[model samples]
Target: MSQSQKKIHYAWVVLIGLIVMVGAAKGGIMTTGGLFLTSITEDLGIGMGSLTLYFSIASIVTMISLPIAGKLIAKYNIRMLLVVAVILEAGSFAMFGFMNSVWGWYLFAIPMAMGSVIVTQLAGPVLINNWFKKHRGLAMGIMVAAGGLLGAFLQPAAGNLIASEGWRNTYFILGLGVMAVVIPVVLLTIRMTPQQKGLQPYGMDEVKHNETIQVEKTANSGVTVAIAKKSSAFYFLIIFFLFDTSIAAFNQHVAPYAVGLGYDIKFAGNAMGSWSVGVVIGALFFGFLSDKIGVKNTAISAMFTGLVPVGILIIEPENPVMFVIATGLYGFVVASLGTLGPLLTTALFGNKEFSRIYGLAIMGLAVAGIVAIPTYGYMFEITGSYTNVLYAIFIMLIMNVGAILLAFKGKKKLEKAGLWN
Candidate 1:
């Protein structure tokens, strides 16, 4: 074989490794966190509100760390950054096993959030954008699907572990497992870009340096952050994210919610697993659909589809089959949000300063996390039911639909003004 044929495009390999590490870490943390909530509260003799506050602290930390983490990733070596991130994330998680009080959670949540922001949120998008030119959206969708798959498997397993071995041992085992697997993967596979391996992105015959230049020029043509902030589109996008994220807060609570409804913990875990299955299917389908149709249509469809599950939950809380269907359908909306959220930003604003603008816009997700999780928890504490939150989610779903419409209006305004091409 010739040198070109023989040359290994290791970036794609790196993408796969990153996907696994991200999947394991996120699946362990986000999907499994609620499994421990009840155990932690009962063991420590704490109120649900108090334990939920730790989740709030984690959100605030996630918001604070994101921009700093973005800047660090840009400035530092990717390998070193990931190493630090894994240590913080997995190590903080492991430390949860030893905690005797709530204060431990509040303190350790800082590092856990910091690490999570790096691995789960930043690394996938940045690395995929750097490595693949031709099928970036598909790459992102696959990466997210991997995480969902892992969540589908791990959530039930984690719940079973907690049921049998107890929460502390589960935390120790999971935390160590994430660090052990991810650290080595990051060291061995991940790199900054394809250029580091002296190759173009997968499937490219030649590097179109000029095409890249033109695309950059178009992306940077006129949309400034200042100008973007002035548009109704920006605010609409924020509202859309906030509502969408608030609805997504349901995932964290699914296991506990199931228990609240008098189901077995294992059954709850399986339901959450079903949720991830829906996420996997939705991410792949909606991602491809967005490419075929338009981001606007895809997003509007997703927001409306999200409402179906809300109705199911409201009307049929006691039926396990209905609960599973509702959570799974909810997962479909979430899958779209994961894929379409960034795509919509790029579609609406172009990619000139995409990182900065995307970073700022996604802070709305953190804001939603900060408000939504605790609010949901407290509502349950006060009302002994999620009915109020469900009603609120329905209202927010309507608002998200409005937000998408407004974003299109803003896009038209930009195009008419010759500010967007």
Candidate 2:
């Protein structure tokens, strides 16, 4: 290795920025969302179903935006994109402070989803893929773990803020606060690729310098977007995405569920915070596990672990101690959405068409949001309980195991057909 190449890689710097940026955007905004659900509905005289429908609306926008976001990220300067993205996202979030009508969330959902598509969903995985060729799973886990760590602190804080300051003021403060923090971080640290820094991706130096091997690597691994789109592996991955998102969507109702059980907002906040802590530990564990055991096995294990929490919720929803423990365990399993999702994609399709295939694949996530978020809310509204939703989530969590197996089975077929070659 050259002496210069041995110097500290800038990819770590990019990752630091990503940890903060995505953390604040997701942990600061998205994870804190449940804290506001009941407060918004009660204050505005809206039903839970009607109010949570805005989340579905936002998901619809996210669904439409993912492909466009993929292209924009490819075409535009990332720093500039992130600056505008955070502004739109946090700005729209703050704008909610002024709305007495549901239309405010509905209208802002467009810009909010657009901005989040760039910030939370796309940037971390895409950039990590560009920068870290080794320990990529670890990198993805750290990014998601940042959100968990930050959200752990933010959730209870937000809950207390809602109690003292009201949801409106809380919204304004969080939005502006995240914007002030995330925008500058983006400009200082993020880059689209390692090439922009005149460096090879981390660990690229380890590859053997043989022409035939390089050619074979490309030939065997370079699954184009067009070919990926036609492959059964791709479709099965999408199905897994859908079921996974559906399972995770139950989190949006955690606070509301607690409230319905007569727990105060502060308790709900603390419970969600516990969930965040679970996320931190879970993300790191799964990432490391994927590296050690493999993505397929780790995913199946996660699905099984996830069932424990769902069962606890079903059997002991009103038990405060059990509720917190269950939700925290559930949060750990949900880390799969961020960690395993991208890892599984790279495992099945390689990185040749990663952005496009992943872009299309995560649309399942948005679609689940559209379908599952308000559906859970309506389940509560209609039944006067969350019992039915819990059952549905349990079923979906088990179904995810099947989906994971099917996805890998399809990938094996693709490899056998020489599509991967």
The TM-score leader among the candidates is: 2
List ranges where model 2 is wrong by over 4 Å.
2-6, 208-220
Candidate lDDT values, in order: 0.82, 0.90
- Candidate 1 lDDT, tens digit per residue, 263-317? 9888888888888888888888887887788789988899889889999989997
Error of 2 at 388 (Å): 1.0
| Tens-digit lDDT track of model 2 for 270-355 | 99999999999999999999999999999999999999999999999888999999999999999989999999998989888888
